[model samples]
Target: MVSDFRKKKLLHLFNKFFDRDGSGSVDRKDFEQAAENISKLRGWKQGDAKYKETLDTLLKVWDGLQSVADANKDGEVTADEWVSMWEAYAKNPSSAYDWQNQYCKFIFQLEDASNDGAIDSEEFSTVYASFGLNKDEAVAAFQKMAKGKANVSWPEFQELWKEYFVTEDPNAPGNFIFGRSSF
Candidate 1:
């Protein structure tokens, strides 16, 4: 059963990033647009290595999402499908879904601009801002997610992400991953 707590966060994530076109479902075009948007946000031009890398990653992420979440094999993933698919692995992820873990690492590395193992408060909002999420909310989220630390390390990031998916506790720092938003 997908508890209401997990369902709320999953829906928030879906509405914010997955269903990028506000089309109620996710398709390749959404990933493509996200790639373009993130690339543009970073000033990465067409054919630039970074741009290409992000595009490829988003595309592959979509592929992985489809394979696992498109239960009807219809090429589009609905919010329910996405949430259900996540339910299968949210508490105990498997190696077969390593893409999900890699995706987190990708975001962490993106924000850790200094090539350091940690992300500072300012860098915390990079991806959220690209997704057009409120910057102030993202900063506030970072403050909460960081738990008073000056920076969030890769290990801490992984923990927070896991908490976001699996923890039902209302006060979990991971609950603030995407800042304040109603799903």
Candidate 2:
């Protein structure tokens, strides 16, 4: 189970992702818009192969989240449902762990711009920039993960994500994955 502090931080990040319209709730349209923005960020031009691939992956993620959080099948995730979903995850952190593993897999595909099956420094920097990190901070974090390697493979990144989300160690390289968190 995550500590209270970490859980709060996770919840904050969850809300940030789900509450896309600033309307205090998440709907199907919000998911579509978020997917569109991510597709654009990945430089996917309309009708391109990667564009459909990336968009499909993102929509799958959205569907997964909706399956978990949309209790009423109303096509929207109300604030209450969102809180309930997190509360359930808090009680059973393994559920969150599994969800995060799938999330990371999707992110890996999206961030691996070169289709190399791994993330190089440049790709890692793109991810950091998306999270609002500066170049120096992103470089430092990537160096820590590199540990003499030129890239981070999927398994290595899974370990990093586990550490980042499941551990409280202040010095964990995964802590820097999301840039500087306000929490």
Candidate 3:
């Protein structure tokens, strides 16, 4: 079972980011929009390889979400469904969500625009900003996760990403992973 706190955090992430276009549920359309936004941010025009790759990866991410979260097979993931999926993952993270790990890897690679093996606050903020999160909040989140460091390495971000999904502590830096949840 998921704690109320965890539910709140997960729902906040879904509503603020994944539920793009305020659809109230996440579907392939959200992934498409997200891919477009990210590709545009990367300055990869439509029909470009980078743009196509982003779309493909995001679609794979959506497929993973559908497989795990869309219990009804309705092609969309509701808030309840989303929270339930997290509950399952939290109970057995090691064995579940290999696709999610891939998504994280893609995001990390996307954020490391400089390809320097680490992600800086500017890079973090820029990518998150496309998700409609406040730039200032993204910066604060970077600070929280980076813990005063100038940049965060892959291992550190992996831990932070896991914590963001599983931890219920409001004060944990991972809570800011999606740029300051409303709850």
Name the best candidate (by lDDT). Answer: 3
**Candidates in descending lDDT order:** 3, 1, 2
Better of 2 and 3 by TM-score: 3
Give the poorly placed runs of model 3, Cα more than 4 Å off: 181-183
Model 3 global lDDT (CA atoms, 0 to 1): 0.85
TM-score winner between candidates 1 and 3: 3
Model 2, 43-82: lDDT tens per residue?
A: 7777888777766766676677788888999877776676
TM-score top scorer: 3
Stretches of candidate 1 exceeding 4 Å from the true structure: 94-96, 181-183
The whole-model lDDT of each prediction reads 0.83, 0.67, 0.85
For model 3, where is the 10-residue window of minimal lDDT? 174-183
Misplaced by over 4 Å in model 2 are: 1-4, 15-18, 71-74, 77-100, 131-133, 144-149, 181-183
Task: List model 1 lDDT by residue over 91-115, tens digit each.
Answer: 5754438678867887787778787
> Residue 157 error for model 2, in Å?
0.8
TM-score of model 1 vs. true structure: 0.92
Pairs of residues at least 3 apart in sequence or in different chains that clash in candidate 1: none
Tens digits of per-residue lDDT for model 3 on 40-144? 898999899999999999999999989888999999999999998888888777766867898879878998999999999999998888877889988988888
Question: Model 3 RMSD to the real structure?
Answer: 1.5
